[model samples]
Target: MLTLTENASTIVKTLAAQAPGSDDTGLRISSTNEEHTAFSVGVADAPEPMDLVVESEGARVFLEPGAAVALDDKVLDATLDDRGSVSFAIGLAE
Candidate 1:
């Protein structure tokens, strides 16, 4: 149930396209700790078999099972810098 802002969606699409991946390319978020507070971000060719796929505005996000539950009510936002770098942030959904 994670929602993505327009900016986030655009950035995700761009990143996925730039990576060597198939049409299902997307941002993959996975928890690194037991508490699920910290996460690793990367572009993946496709979701894992157990991943929760979230899509918006043609943008795709694959979340690990734990990450999906932790972010179930969260919103994703992103900002692109002048240097062509992207940063993603998460927050509680309104």
Candidate 2:
């Protein structure tokens, strides 16, 4: 299963709270290709059929089946750069 770091959960929760109608919204992760190498993240009001729901730090995440398979055992982390930009990092779980 895909996991979110403390920072990632915090960032996602903050973003969701700022969006309109976010009470039911979750960060959705999906792949654009069959290979599942290319992925995108966005706020979704609900999970698609067969999607996996992951919850951490009060934040919800919906993972498409393909993305779930590709990201299994991986950790998603959020970081703020010196330039005041936020970015996400994915890697093997520690």
Task: Give the number of the best model, judged by lDDT.
Answer: 1
User: Candidate 2: where are CA atoms >4 Å away?
Assistant: 81-85
Candidate 1, 1-94: lDDT as tens digits: 9999999999999999999969999999999999999999999999999999999999999999999999999999999889988888999999
- Please give the range of 10 consecutive residues that has the lowest summed lDDT in model 1: 80-89
Q: What are the Cα lDDT values of the candidates?
A: 0.95, 0.87
lDDT of 2 by residue, 23-93 (tens): 77888899889999888998788788899999998988899999999998999898877996768778998
TM-scores for all candidates: the values are 0.97, 0.88
Candidate 1 TM-score over all chains jointly: 0.97
Provide the global lDDT of candidate 1 against the true structure.
Answer: 0.95
Off by more than 4 A, model 1: none
